[model samples]
Target: MSIKDIDDIVVHDISKFRPQEDISLDSTKKKIVEKIKLQLKLNNTSIRKLAEKTGMKHPQILRVTSGENYNIETLIRILDALNLEILIKEKDKNSNDQLMNTAAL
Candidate 1:
């Protein structure tokens, strides 16, 4: 059964989830980061544990969670460790929000 309309989906507490360092990201990057944050929350995993799994230090994961750094390789590794994968698909340009919000991480 369909759970909800894509446009109706909401991710709660992304901004308040963790202490972030001062970081600047364009709106698209910020949306991606927020979706990643949501995925982490959904997986019930912590950055420290993810670090241990990925052989990366806490600070590196912290950059990802905090939006200070988002090297694609780093994100891919992190997502892989979480048993997640990215699937990019074409969407209507006017429907960017739903496309990103419903991205399969």
Candidate 2:
């Protein structure tokens, strides 16, 4: 069967599909950027000040936090300067099973 056939047959329940990984990643990235921006605002720090504090270029900081090209190492340094930690956790078993079922469709 063609992809269109699979798409038609598998979409029985719109809500059953788990978010695509890239969508989740983008959401996570946006959240991190917002947190970093908030931290800067709360501290009354400008991008230039943050750059000086983190030893990163101002343009690079702007680009990363603006959802352009993202660099994990640079983001880590910035987050460290802002005293933030990244967390990772696995989904509960039911959620995992649901996602698997959705993907197999």
Candidate 3:
């Protein structure tokens, strides 16, 4: 059956749609660091090599790659060195699930 062939479709009210909650910077930063580490591994780069390329300390880079808390500036530098850009957008305030779904998409 085609979508237009359906006779019992219901449309939800957009006014009732909830906005999504924003993710904490810490959680988002951690995810970004992990992704960068994965990409580095795929490129055959070591942790030390990444640190050197980013002009960050080897120990600090290790901590970041291991999911330790680091400053936003440090994270930004690392991402930039990896050719990644951080995009920040104000999230809707009603629904966390919706925000996550949108981000995933």
Best by lDDT: 2
Which of the predicted structures, 1 or 3, would earn the higher TM-score when compared with the native? 3
lDDT per residue for candidate 3 within 27-55, as digits (tens), equals 56567777988888788888888889988
For model 1, residues 5-105, the per-residue Cα lDDT tens digits are 77687887564433233221344567666876787799898889889989999999888877675689998998788777788888566666554443322
Model 2's TM-score against the true structure: 0.67
Q: Compose the digit string of candidate 2's lDDT tens values, residues 1-105.
A: 998887787555654355667545666678888999999999998989999999989998998779877678998999898888888798678975775566566
| Pairs in steric clash, model 2 | none
Please give the CA lDDT of all the candidate structures: 0.72, 0.81, 0.73
TM-score of 3: 0.58
User: Using Cα atoms with residue i matched to residue i, what is each candidate's TM-score against the true structure?
Assistant: 0.57, 0.67, 0.58
Local distance difference test, candidate 1: 0.72
Scanning candidate 1 in windows of ten residues, the lowest lDDT window is 16-25
lDDT of 2 at 101: 68
Residue 69, candidate 3: C-alpha displacement in angstroms: 1.3
